[model samples]
Target: MGKEHVIHTDGACRNNGRDNPQGAIGVHSERGSISERLPASMERHTNNMAEHAAINRGLKSAPYDNNPVVIKTDSELCQKTFGGGWAQQWERNGGRTAGGSKPANYDFVQDTMKEVNYRRSQGQDVRFEHVRGHAGDSGNQRAHDLAQQGLGQGAPQYKYGGRY
Candidate 1:
């Protein structure tokens, strides 16, 4: 196994859970960083969506090599969903929760899963670590700041190469 690559991701939203919520996702790693508004195509804009989107983008940005990649995020949902088998179980259950209702941010969850499955197919070990938000972790702080900055920017033009 090669040295692990750590990428910190975060999300931010303005006026979340209200009318016309705007959200953004951020990704930061030793290689580079990304900050951009959530795509307009997303049906609803919420902080959770932004959080999942950040993990999706972060996974997409990971190198296509054999090195183990660790995704650090403040969102425990993201960590558990992708790293703790929630997605797999949800998928096995036809993308529905145990209550027979669709999970929130289901599309984003699938997108992240696709990236993770692809990376694993390529012999990459993907992991997720939960880092408490705004707790003075430099990488998480940088990702948070980037997501905040993304709120002011327009939608991203460059594609990170994913199905969704």
Candidate 2:
């Protein structure tokens, strides 16, 4: 086992067919500074998609060790889906709707959940923690800002390092 850590991720989709989309990931030591890790883009997408990508990227950035992780995010949907373990059901069904149809955001949700659970199985204590946005949470704020910036016509850094 090793020391635990904290990670915060955020994403944004500026507009569809009119604006670009972006995702950002921020990581912090349980005891110190935060790291901003993610790439922003100007591609068409939805906020949900960006948010999911942020969580996925954050999970991937975490080290695979027997250490606990506190994954922070501003997306309530993302938090609940991962924390409640319901994301598994969505994945097991191949991102399909219960009515034998297709869900709008089922694919990414299922894929991301699979990755999150996989990380957990690899000894990484990847726990989802919900955080309020624009309420003086430095890490969350930075991630949000980065996500917005990522919706530009350029590439942004996916990882950032600093104290929250």
Best by lDDT: 1
Candidate 1 per-residue lDDT, tens place, 4-83, comes to: 88999998889998988888888999889998887666767889988988888887887888999999999998888888
Q: Over the full model, what C-alpha lDDT does candidate 1 score relative to the true structure?
A: 0.86
Compared with the true structure, what per-residue lDDT tens digits does model 2 show for residues 11-113? 7654443544334334333443333323443234566766776776666666667787778988888887788665765566775545656655565666666
Cα-based TM-score, every candidate? 0.93, 0.72
Q: Look at candidate 2 and tell me the lDDT of residue 143.
A: 74
Local distance difference test, each candidate = 0.86, 0.63
lDDT for predicted candidate 2 compared with the true structure: 0.63
In model 2, the Cα lDDT at residue 58 comes to 66
